[model samples]
Target: MATGWLCHELYMWHNTGNWAQVFPPGLTVQPGTHAENPETKRRFRNLVEVSGLLNHLVQISPRPATPDEIARVHTREHIAHIKALSDAGGGDASWLTPLGAGSYEIALLAAGGAIAAGEGVVSGEVTNAYALIRPPGHHAQPNLAMGFCLFSNAAVAIRHLQARLGVGRVATVDWDVHHGNGTQAIFYEDPTVLTISLHQENLYPPNSGSISENGTGRGLGFNLNIPLPPGSGAAAYRAAFERVVIPALHRFKPELIVVPSGFDASGVDPLGRMMLSSGAYRELTHLLLSAARELCGGRILMTHEGGYSEMYVPYCGVAVLEELSGVKTHVDDPWQPLMMAWGGQDLQPHQSLVIDKVAALVARIS
Candidate 1:
């Protein structure tokens, strides 16, 4: 099992400036490191190397996605807007989303990294791959950038696969603790791609990711949203996969599986209220791998998304990578025991109700 890793140093250079968490500095908000800073991604990369896992994977290089490539999913005006702002030494892309000089170029590279990872998996260059690119992109819309995202990386890559790579059906499994509004909207009217998001209810981007927000037109019933309650943990997530996600995949029968992977659902993450350990993420990956092997010849590609915990994100990332590559390293997550023992780790009746409701939607996929 050759798992490919795609990353570029410049990915860490796409600066979001000094803002307190998600806010710009003001009289009330003091200047501090942004929650979307590079440390979380950098630490994930560092652990892969320090734990000897890096040496076991295939390394794929990223190239800048051309304007034509980006045009597949973004509007011309929106593309030019980001470039203009980036050229003028940086400015806000949207509410709570800031960028520094040269960020536009880096955003292009981030989208390109997604393309590279997808290509690696589709072309059989690697059995599976993970692109650790930055400037998280799932929150970006066709003409607006928000939620710390500048481009819809996963959406752009899925478009490229359909238009240029001759691939037909693709499915996205987004577990970001926030709604994947951008990806959902981009493919909302098309049935070729199935977008399933498991997120905290009403967490980010207000009034989004509702269970009733299924697909539209020809895409009706193709999109599924599992808005788990705020305190959902390992058992809830596992039950979601077993009951809803995996069955939807079996019904859709996609040729490739793309994950907008995010670790923000970690118990200690300041941005979310879910209680999940690295072990839970490992199990999720295991389930996905089994489904991919059975349905898609083991073709899976993942691109990084929102994960704000600088200390714990690396452990979750390493666990997923370890599962993908089938290699074990000496590194063990110190926080796992405590996270697994959290009060809500067991599946509660309330969580089961939500899962049961979403599971009924699976029969509508075909």
Candidate 2:
């Protein structure tokens, strides 16, 4: 039950300059902390230490991904653009995605962290691992950086596993509240990788993650998007997994399972409109672990993604780590009781309809 953990002090140093959450401060807008700041990730690491869970986990050191490694998933121009911006002392990577000096190097480190975690699981160095790296990468694309992401960390890691480690049939289950557009696009036409994203419908990136946006060419039906309605909760998510996610994984039978884990789907996150609690995340982790055990030799690698609630992200992270490591701490999520009791925590008929549609797509995965 060895769970590999990766974090670097420099991860917190990737500066996203002072801007109101996702916007540059102006006369009309007040300057405040950016939504993707370091506090959430730093606090998550700290809580792991405070909860004594860090002691039970194996630490994995991360190296900066080589330009060639990043090129596996990103274009040379896009890579050069980020480096130039960082060299010029920081600028926006794309719409609303900003970075500061040395951010290019930090982004490389984040991608490397993801690769390290995947290597740990694939090499049997750890049963499963979680890389709590910063500057979330799910929203990044091959040529453009969007949301708060620079490099598509999960995509880079998956490419590394396939091209370098001789692994095949990798599946990514992204429950990040926002569409994993980048990861989806990277493997959209490739049948070897199954990309499943359970996100809020049309929340970010505008008009993306529709049920019809499955996959194209040979990859059709291999990509699944369960766009749960806003305010979806534990019941909706559980239904999606049992009816869509787990079934797809079983059909695909991936050699490794990658999770773009994000806590923004939690009840307290400012960016998302969902109502999931820490308990819900624990349940989801349990389900994924069971599926991995049966389908992928129990190899699961989770790379950190969008989660803005500094206060609550730590609890949600700990819950997942506890399940991953089979170690429980005395710390309890004080927000669970309230979040679980909130309205719309049960599965609505509308949510069921969405899940049913996505469930049908699972049959297409050969």
Per-candidate clashes, comma-separated = 0, 0
* Best-fitting candidate, scored by lDDT: 1
Stretches of model 2 off by over 4 angstroms after superposition:
none
Query: Candidate 2 — worst ten consecutive residues by lDDT sum?
Result: 17-26
Off by over 4 Å in 1: none
Q: Write the per-residue lDDT of candidate 2 for residues 42-82, one digit (tens) a residue.
A: 99999999999999999999989999999998999999999
Cα lDDT of model 2 overall?
A: 0.94
Candidate 1: give the clashing pairs: none
RMSD of each: 0.6, 0.6
Tens digit of per-residue lDDT, candidate 1, span 1-366: 799999999999998998999989999989999999999999999999999999999999999999899989999999999999999999788898999999999999999999999999999999999999989999999999999999999999999998988999999999999999999999999999999999999998899999999999999999999999999999999999999999999999999999999999999899999988999999999999999999999999999998989999999999999999999999999999988988989999999999999999999898
